[model samples]
Target: MNWIEIAGHTGALLSSITFIPQVYKVWKTKSVGDLSLYMMLIVFTSTLVWLAYGVALNLWPVILANGFICFLSILLLYFKFAFSRKVIVVAKVKESE
Candidate 1:
């Protein structure tokens, strides 16, 4: 492969791994209370679009990065809901006290 291909693959690898920290945080804390659900929704939606665009254009780097991002965003959305529910429960308990 040429340098360009190498660079593209490298970028894809780096971007894919970048989601690890967020995933770890969500997994460890089971909390995403400070995360913006709306923002993540928009980002997830946009990543889907980007993946489609990459597929249409046959751009491997874009496709790879956005695909992983789509998965990560979904995970984030799940955690956001879970965390929000916990927060609501806590609030109710405190209110009752």
Candidate 2:
């Protein structure tokens, strides 16, 4: 492959791998207290748009990278909701006491 293809693949790999730490932290802690749900939602939506654009253009790199990002973003959204509900329950219990 040419240098351009190598660079594109490298960039895609790096971006996708960067989500690993966040995923691990959330999974290990079972918490997403500090993460911004709004931001993630926006990003997830943007990634979906990018994936669609990639599909239209038939760009494999864009499609692959955004696809992986969409997956990770969904996980993050799940954790965000789960943790937020936990926090609310805790708060309500404390208030009741």
Candidate 3:
């Protein structure tokens, strides 16, 4: 591959991994207290747009990166809601006790 393509792939690789640590941490700790819902929504929306752009242009790097990012974003969103509910339920139980 040419330098330009290499750079694109390199960027794709980096972008794809950006959310991994955060996802892992949230998964491990079952905590979403610090994660902003708006930020996650914005990122998820942006990744979907980028994924569409990549597909329209047949750009493999963009497609791969954004697609993976989309998955990660979804996981984060799910985790945020799921964990938040758990926290709320626990709080209610504690209050009742």
Alpha carbon lDDT of each predicted model: 0.86, 0.88, 0.94
Off by over 4 Å in 3: 1-5
lDDT of each residue in 20-92, candidate 1, tens digit only = 7987998898878777889889979999999999999999878878998899988888888887798899989
> What is the total number of backbone clashes in candidate 1?
0
Per-residue lDDT tens digits for candidate 2, residues 22-86, read: 97899899888788889889879989999999999999988988899999999889888987799
Highest TM-score scorer: 3
Which segments of model 2 are wrong by more than 4 Å? none
Rank candidates, TM-score, best first.
3, 2, 1
When 2 and 3 are scored with lDDT, the better candidate is: 3
- How many steric overlaps are in each model, in order? 0, 0, 0
- Against the hidden true structure, what lDDT does model 3 obtain? 0.94
Instruction: Give the per-residue lDDT of model 3 (tens digit) for 1-97.
Output: 8999899778879989999999999999999999999999998999999989999999988888889999999999999999999988989999988
Q: Cα deviation of 97 in candidate 2 (Å)? A: 4.8
Worst 10 residues of 3 by lDDT: 6-15
